[model samples]
Target: MLNKTASRSFYLNLWLGLVGLVVGIFAGFAVGISPALLLVAIVAVAGLIWFFASFEQAVIGLLILRSSLDLFSAQQLPAAFAIALNALTILYVLVALLTGKAVKIDKFWWFFALWIIFQSLWVILLPLGGLGMDASFLMSGVRVWLRYFSWLMVYLLVMQLKDNVPPEKIVSMLLLSLVAPISIALLQIFLPSSMLPSLLTSQGKAGSNVSGTLGFPNGLGIFLTMFIALVWWKLSISSKRLPWLLLLGLVSFVFVRTGYFTGLVAVLLLILFINSTKITPVRAIGVVLFCCAFLWMFASTEFGQQRLTEIYDTPLLNPNIDVSRSIILSYGDSNSFNWRIAHWTYLINAWSQFPILGYGLDTSPLLGIRDFNTGSGYAPHNDYIRFLVEQGVVGLTGFLCFLVGQGWYLVHLLRNSQSVNSRRNLCLILIALFVANIVSMLTSNIMDATTFFFYWWTLVAIAGWGNEYWRPNLATKSA
Candidate 1:
């Protein structure tokens, strides 16, 4: 009778605890915190709880939050979301350490950490002969490092959680998150501007380009390119292939409408690479014929004609001077292409002045490279050049080492992974994603684009997870 009484007390107390927790959460919401923030808080708490209970659920929630961020203007979101994620990451690492989980630390992460430390020191010291540091510039540099570190934290979290989550689940969560963005993008393309939210409307030069919920057409193109590769890879290994292929076709069409030449080229190269092993003499001839036919058909369209005109109208070639110099000098100061060239030239010049360490993070714009018309400082669109001008040889070297290390690890996984076919397909997708990103970086400041950076690292973390936990002999392989 005493034992029964104690059990009843325990159950009642447990129920009251849960009820009190819910009421407390409601009370906080009722006290007039912004709905956005309240929502983030609720999600964060739930995610933390889920993280402790089930690692896979926490990862899925994180991915969903990350993907949803693209739809809204990032500036409007609360910083609490990032704080929550970082807190969870730190806690997870501590727990893993306490529990003796075999946490693998990639050497690339150390290099990246060194790079961040170097930037932090440079910002603090404000060394002589560097770009003059002001409070505003210093704060901006701090913000840059904070953002980089936040993303890096996510990468680290994924590394720790990789063994706990299945690769297929990661892919599924990514695809599920993509559904809303993809649907919105396709709708914007078909629907009139009046039917869409102003935020979702096309802001590109032509009314035809759709940014979807990503807020930038080029960003959408990059996002689509990565997923298109993913969907294509998924189709290649699936029996229910037609639907995925159709989705890929739709995504490819939208990607072209973005009119981002670099993204398009990257996707094309990815497709070519994927098909390289299948090419036979007969298939090669057929491929060439199909390409010729497609080109002929494309030339007949008004849109294609405009695109061709834009390409040909550019002064790419001149007969009056040495070919190389003429090509180099052809870009007019006012031309967009020339603008990028000018930025690159300026960055190169700036890097030459400080070859070893450069001006420091976020200092490129302040170093007297202003737009002539607006007199506003501009960033070099190319990340490589920006790194050269801002972080210099030491920083750039660290950056390169990280990239090379990541590539090596991916390759190593591909060669040695005896995982299920789904896992291998994911590995291939990661390789393709890396290639596409590298190519896209040539034309855009990809590292600075938060949406792309988050997705890229998240995917990498997923791949790493697959490498560790998704192998055939693992207990969860069947999962």
Candidate 2:
């Protein structure tokens, strides 16, 4: 029976591969994109063939492509090509799980599972709620809802690696993954604008803040921040931290060069909090001085000067004020913070109509159409507004509960930390990120930033696996 099942699966995958290759070819040709992109399409098809051949290969392939796909969005690649790849990704992972493939499932898994259930329900019923009836709107919302599945897949696959793969092997894989993103950052920094493809670049000045592989400066910030934390954890535990010095330096350079302040701000706060972990006073002082020096350099940059000197016209709240989106945007020097405030105001008003279950997942862009003159909407920017507008009150409630539980769990781990330096450092970084996220999420997309979260949750899932694998030791230590 197993042989027959395998034979059938192979045949089905073969059929799908042929169809996919044909479609990918047409997609490449239809766009009349450069020959270079056509070559990429060929490579993509070849990669897909490998993915379909084995579940393990598919999982690993996704990890390897984590950074690239972030840059090669619908903006870089054709929309059809991007959707096809993402849909195929979702299909393969879901099929594997349904076919009795086991994954790590514990207390946190329940939290993840329950909230995910609501996402599907939102997709099906959003049209009825008068939110996602238009084809584009409905499809957009569906894609956003399904985005979680991609992260779920990453978490499950990474968890599986804990026992079967050695830590050094995973470290090596991460080192390999670092290549493309850092290379792109260097290109953006050194190469002239005319030398790079428009798809690979954004509207940043030549000398400052460029989007690396993640397509946006902030996205690069998030990825590099998580990556830096991972490196720190590795070095913290290793007897010979010297080996990681070069890798650390490369990552740090790209991180600083990108000039996305979000991750830096978060890490700066974290460095101060690390004193609670009982580092030497001298080391703590050194960290403070290093941060201060970096801040001085950062503030001296033209872009940093603009961001720092800008003022928000709208206060956080006021009973008497005409703080509409247009009004907020009218100021020639309007801060992005005020823009978020205006967009959020419009989203909240529309969300009031569907307060129970929200209009639909990812519909916030369309829901805030009233705020946009171009008749196109923007992201809520704030994850709180995102959940409140799309997932509604119930979803938000579930999310907060899950967050509180996660924070508690991390605290518990830190308090009763075993003799493992790596694990303790892991808990510290996670907790710091958790707290930082609470602040960042108020102004950034924390939940559905797939490219960034894909890596973030992979590290997190390793911690989840560690929680189970080291339970006996932890229990003994607690006793």
Candidate 3:
């Protein structure tokens, strides 16, 4: 009797399941299978994963995806990827808040939050207040706000994880994130352009310059500079240092190939600082090998030869050349050191018109895009000047405060943290990266959607994490 009842129930449930499947298929077909539906599905899945996964896992996955995204051009990927990233970030923050996690909010974070809020308000008000409210302009402003908010969310999420997650795990995740981009960059250099994705080629100009997977050489340079510093720092302290040294050499090779002068300067400064400390015989030999390999590659590669020529041949270095003439001439040619100087002048002049508040969020690019024909646009190339032009004095002040706050905090941490603690080494690495980024920003807009944002805020997140959980021990050591 029990068997007969069970068989009947199973058949009934199977029939209902079949009916539901048919209904779902009909519903999907009726919806016309648009991109929007696909996007919704993607978001749903990502949301579920974030909801179920541990915070550390979710963040690591996001960072890896973000690094992968750097390999493809923006047009190549669906908008859903970006949407999902933002949604997951928000979800993480909401969950943290709901779970009553002890979030570490410092003065720097408050300043940054204020800066974001200030910029976002202008983004909304500027469009309605005589900026014409065109959809394109408004959308551009919106995108800028989204980037800022996404960064904030990441920082907050990392802060929440400080007590729960191990520092080694976080560092490993960061190192792993670089593997894909570095590998792709190495491949691009050796493989013919025709064999690789056309989008990966620098501006679709064959053999022009390799941008790696970031689609922009300077962007790749910024990314490489940060990791190079981190790897070098790791090598300085680790007993098993060979792997770090090898990775450093690989990254340094790619960094030199990018031909970003500011990044080069940052790396040189990092080397000088690191060398100040005692070096073991092994590390010294590794450094010597890295230098030899770099020199050989630099001499052998066409791109490297051209970059060398450009660096040495710049007229700005000539004592005979008038500074004004050099600036004028270089600005005409584009992508020159003097050109950057001229660009800064133009942006500062423009900023004078609305120096108090400036234009608005993301407006600098719109204003500067007109100059794209000259091989450089209104990007201001310098993030400092870019912010000055867009946000003016008030916005610039807030940004500086946030930057200075971070720098001040890190310096304190370095002074107090125990020499033996891993956090101290990590703090030094973060300090070096922060300096490198600041240096790179002087010549390139390093705060954009590229690897810049990911690396920058990762530093911030780590710093925040350290400040919250690691300070007591550091304080004791200092005392």
Give the CA lDDT, 0 to 100, for residue 410 in model 1. Answer: 78
Model 1 Cα displacement at 177 (Å)? Answer: 2.3
- Tell me the spans in candidate 1 whose CA falls farther than 4 Å from its real position: 1-47, 78-80, 98-108, 111-115, 127-132, 202-207, 278-308, 313-335, 366-375, 418-420, 465-468, 471-479
TM-score of each: 0.77, 0.76, 0.80
lDDT of 1 at 395: 74
By TM-score, rank the candidates, best first: 3, 1, 2
Candidate 1 lDDT score at position 126: 53
Give one digit per residue, the lDDT tens place, for model 1 in 12-34.
Answer: 56655785698577758755867
Question: How good is model 3 by TM-score?
Answer: 0.80
* lDDT for position 104 in model 3: 62
* Model 2 deviation from the true structure expressed as Cα RMSD, one decimal place: 6.2
Instruction: Give one clash count per candidate, in the order shown.
Output: 1, 0, 1
What TM-score quantifies how close candidate 2 is to the native fold? Answer: 0.76
The CA-based lDDT of model 1 is what?
A: 0.65
Candidate 2 segments whose C-alpha is farther than 4 A from its true place: 1-58, 75-104, 130-136, 202-207, 242-250, 256-259, 311-330, 369-373, 412-417, 467-479
